[model samples]
Target: MDFSDTIGVSAAGMNAQSTRLRIAAENLANKDTTATTHGGDPYRRKTVTFKEELNRQTGVSSVKVKEIGQDQTPFEQRYDPAHPAADAKGYVKMPNVNSMVEIMDTHEAQHSYEANLNTMQITRSMLTRTINLMK
Candidate 1:
């Protein structure tokens, strides 16, 4: 692959990772968010799905975000009798988000983003050196 293809692939990867990081951040921020209505469903964790796409003209493959979907995991129940969202049984539906899992996801996405950024930078540097040599 040429320099542009390498850079394009890295850019696609970075975009995917950034979306993952954003979703993780959203999940973490809504971790404590409970439903305003009694017995209503709480915030569901969001998930990111990726797919590979090929640029027919460039003959390059890159990553793309397939979808941002809700997690199927059931919400947790917490007993908070005085809370506004508490049901008749005195249990409130809690968000499915786990702080530890969100933190780990954030860490992984950050590393992946950095790796893609590094790849792009390296490709650019190589391109620059080639130009300088040709001159």
Candidate 2:
């Protein structure tokens, strides 16, 4: 196996984690949003799905985002008679995003991204040392 393949694989992982982080941020931002119209659907939580693909050039498996889909979980109902989005029963539908869950996801993505970055840095160092020794 080529040593440079490690950097390529790690870069793919970092990209995937970045996408995940973005999705998590979007979900957190919309967590408090409600539908503007009565009895309308509120902003649903978003989720990212990852897939692995083989790099034809290096034969290494790399990570990629398969899809960014909405969470299927039901929305939460809050009683607020004064809310413009309230239904006939004085209930407003809230986004399904859970702040705690989104926070955890964001943390995970950050850790993964950092790990990939470290791997890439180490690979670069190894390559640099090899080139120096050849001189």
True-structure lDDT of candidate 1: 0.95
Q: On residues 1-135, what C-alpha lDDT tens digit does candidate 1 reach at each position?
A: 999999999999999999999999999999999989877898999999999999999889999999999999988999999988999999999999999999999999999999999999999999999999999
RMSD of candidates 1 onward, in order = 0.7, 0.9
lDDT, model 1, position 62? 98
Cα error, candidate 1, residue 120 (Å): 0.6
Q: How well is each residue in 1-135 modelled by candidate 2, as lDDT tens digits?
A: 667789888989999999999999999999999999888899999999999999887778989999999899999999998998998899999999999999999999999999999999988999999999999
Which consecutive 10 residues in model 1 have the weakest lDDT in total? 34-43
Error of 2 at 45 (Å): 0.5
Best by TM-score: 1
With a 3 Å backbone cut-off (N, CA, C), the pairs that clash in candidate 1 are: none
